[model samples]
Target: MARPSSDRLGYLLVAPTVLILLSITAFPLAYNLWNSLRHVVLTDPSSAGFAGLENYRALLGDPQFAQVLARTSLFTVVSVSVQMAVGLMVALVLHRRFRGRGLVRAAVLIPWAVPTVVAAISWKTMLDPQSGVLSFLFGVDTAWLAGEWTAWIAIAVADGWKTVPFVAIILLAGLQVIPGDIYEAARVDGSGAWHAFWKLTLPLLKPALMVALIFRTLSALLIFDVIFILTGGGPGDTTETLSYVTWREFLVESDFGGGGAVSVLMLVLSLVIAGAYTRLFRLDRREG
Candidate 1:
């Protein structure tokens, strides 16, 4: 029949993309699972044999893994929270039409347009202890990456600067989609701007805010390039995140088995967080 032939043609048309996704994503994940169960190391690739769950057990027992997990959680929590706050403020300001609004919007996106490596290098230069702009401007020579707190601050600054604009853009789109009549109605009901914002705007913007938070949280959890280029997980590994630890295991220490285990753990953590967000968003959407 024509319908059967059409379905077959459609399947053939989409087959290549599905095959590519499976090859690139599914295959690597499967390979990593197999690799994690082995004892492969840089110096003993030939002697590598199945080690079962030993790598995962060792990873769980390692205290450094615990510290990295803690640091990663703090980083993701603090950075995502700050980025959302700043982004919401920016979005609220841009929601209203004003003179040079388009120019302002474009300017805000400039930070987001810059590459992560470039932003990291720039922030590192700006925050350097000696001959840095902050020290020169403030007349205080403080090492931004020398102390754990300072290093975290520097990393947060760079990340928030780069990502806040993305959150703002998403929220701005949501704000624009909101009907103007709602605000007019609130005004007619003698509601102050603050009341209307907190009562109406915030509730309406919940879906967009959740989406932005999930995106920013995931990205913040996987933060590496900025910290790597800026602090190198220095100050006695105080700034070492899970991604950094994973990178060090595979690339620096050349322990494929341990690295694969870390990768699996990272994947699981991300999935858990994403799943929570997905469930919350679905519930919100149903209510809305």
Candidate 2:
């Protein structure tokens, strides 16, 4: 055989990585898509057959799914917004030159470093109605996770507590890359801190914000671990997210086809949110 060019050699070198990705990710995705078009109720093995678009159509027509999607959207929106706002504050504080800043930064990361399930379980224990810390301290014995709305709040609080530090870390990275000279110039021009942040910091931090938003939004939309540990979509499906619903279908109900359809829908929702953020921020364009 003739000697391969550098380009060809590069492709050959990358081929293994590409193949590995296809095997792990693409293969499962393809299989899920295939399954979504069929009947896959585990209780009815003999019922498996091609039923093009039936799963999708039935899912769309499901009022319960509609409720689940809306709740998921609400959770994602509220959690991401809260995380970003809190993260921005923490990032600003971390960016400041102060004593013990290093320790503070590391300490902030503890929650993020902890495993999600562990953190959720810890929160669940702490929020227990009868004898939990909150109940003991407040002296009212309010059941934090008993009611529908309260359970959602408890889940959001737990998720936010665990993930806010991560958002802070990302935002801090973005904040550091910004040139100090720009802020100095703004100050010299009589721009107040609030004004400068609104005009300069936000615009400059657009790239990082977009990245954090996409990550957190996707995480929020697909939120399951916290819900699983804290609420279990219980109290009559009040906290039922789409990801939880998918899990219920596949494992609890043993309807692989329906679960596959929901998985596809989740993927589409993620793509749509990512695309919206990219377009909203004009992320691809070079700012002159």
Candidate 3:
């Protein structure tokens, strides 16, 4: 009887907080779903009606949306891959005992600490063809953000510069928790640095790698600020992502139903990607 009473009291204590959280998150989601199922163009109020799945069907049938989806996926893959590679290298370097190691660590975090908009703007300025430092150094007059591939390269570099430190920090934490004795034993067994890293370090770093990969992948998939500030999805909408499309629908086109549908789709995509990453990591752990 006492145990049951105590459990009830505990539940009562947390009930308010749980309810608040649900109200904040669940209510908005429910509203968005409702909005998605109706035609709600702000400019054309008389045309509003029940849309059912019409918005989704229209989005799916559009060739531009298909291109945007593919572009977003490719950008996510490229940005996450580059960030992981560079971050791992930085983590390995930071793990070593060196002069001014603390300073180097702090310096490495400066890029990540900067605001995303500021970072994007800085990159935009640096890539300016007429007066940019990069153009002067490379002795080329190419407009970095004017071309399709070059613009992507610029965005990738900017995003990587801002995010690689976060991945490195996560990896560095994982590295620190690893037992040094294992490395000593490997060295005694005549295993070289590369062999030890491949056979021992990587296996132990899986959890941190998974965390970093999931975070960076999701951020890349929903990327908006950098593209908004730098390219504005210009040079013929080549860099526009799903998030941008959603924004265009809601804010630009005044199509609330279309925007709501895009938002719901984005939510679904995020959930699916997160679940996939969690499952993949679990599988890797089981295999290991």
Candidate 4:
């Protein structure tokens, strides 16, 4: 009886928070799902009718949407991979005691603290062929955003510069929690630095690595502000991502059904990526 009462009390304590979360998240999601199934064109209000997955069918088979999806996937993979590698390197460097380590860490984190739009704008100016610092230094007047691959590279670099620091901070925290005794023991066993790091550090760092990967992957999937500010999906829509397509559908073209479907797809993609990471890393299971 006491256990049941305690559980009831626990539920009562959490009920308000649960309701609040549902009100904010569940309500909007339900609304979006509802809209995704109906043809609610802003221009053709009278033509609004039940779409019944028609919007999804059209968008899924859309060549333009297909291209955007591919670009978004590629961007996510490249951005997350680069961020993880660079972040791991930084974390390793910072894990060691050095002169002005605090200052160096803080300096590295400054970019992470900067606003996304501001960073995007700054990078755009730097990469601009006319009167841009990078172009001036290289002594070439080629437009970076005008090229297909160069445009993606520019966006990835800007995003990586702003985000790699966050990954490093997370990884650094993971590195700090590791016991020094273990490394000393490895050294006693004549284990080289590379052997210890490869055998011990990476295995222990899986949790943090998965976390950083998922977060950065999700951010890359929904990437819009940076691309919007830098390129605006220009150069023949080659730079447009799924999120960008959704915005164009809903806001630009006023295709409510199509936009809502794309938005739902994005939500699904995020969940899938997060779930895959969690499962791949077995984050829930305790290491023996």
lDDT of each: 0.92, 0.92, 0.94, 0.92
Query: How many steric overlaps does candidate 2 have?
Result: 0
| Global CA lDDT computed for model 3 | 0.94
What does the lDDT come to for candidate 4?
0.92
Can you write out model 2's per-residue Cα lDDT over 14-113, one digit (the tens) per residue? 9999999999999999999999999999999999999899999999999999999998998888889999999989999999999999999999999999
Residue pairs in steric clash, candidate 3?
none
Superposed by TM-score, candidate 4 places the C-alpha of residue 261 at a distance from the truth, in angstroms, of 0.6
Per-residue lDDT tens digits for candidate 3, residues 28-125, read 99988998999999999999999999999998999999999999999998789989999999999999999999999999999999999999999999
What's the lDDT for residue 224 in model 1? 92
Error of 3 at 47 (Å): 2.1
Best by the lDDT measure: 3
lDDT of 4 at 5: 94
Query: What clash pairs does model 1 have?
Result: none
For each candidate in turn, the TM-score is 0.97, 0.95, 0.95, 0.94
- Model 3: worst 10 consecutive residues (lDDT sum): 279-288
Weakest 10 consecutive residues of candidate 1 by summed lDDT:
39-48
Give the residue spans of candidate 2 off by over 4 A: 1-5, 283-288
Estimate the lDDT of model 2: 0.92
TM-score of 4: 0.94
Best candidate according to TM-score: 1
Residue 18 displacement in candidate 3 (angstroms): 1.7
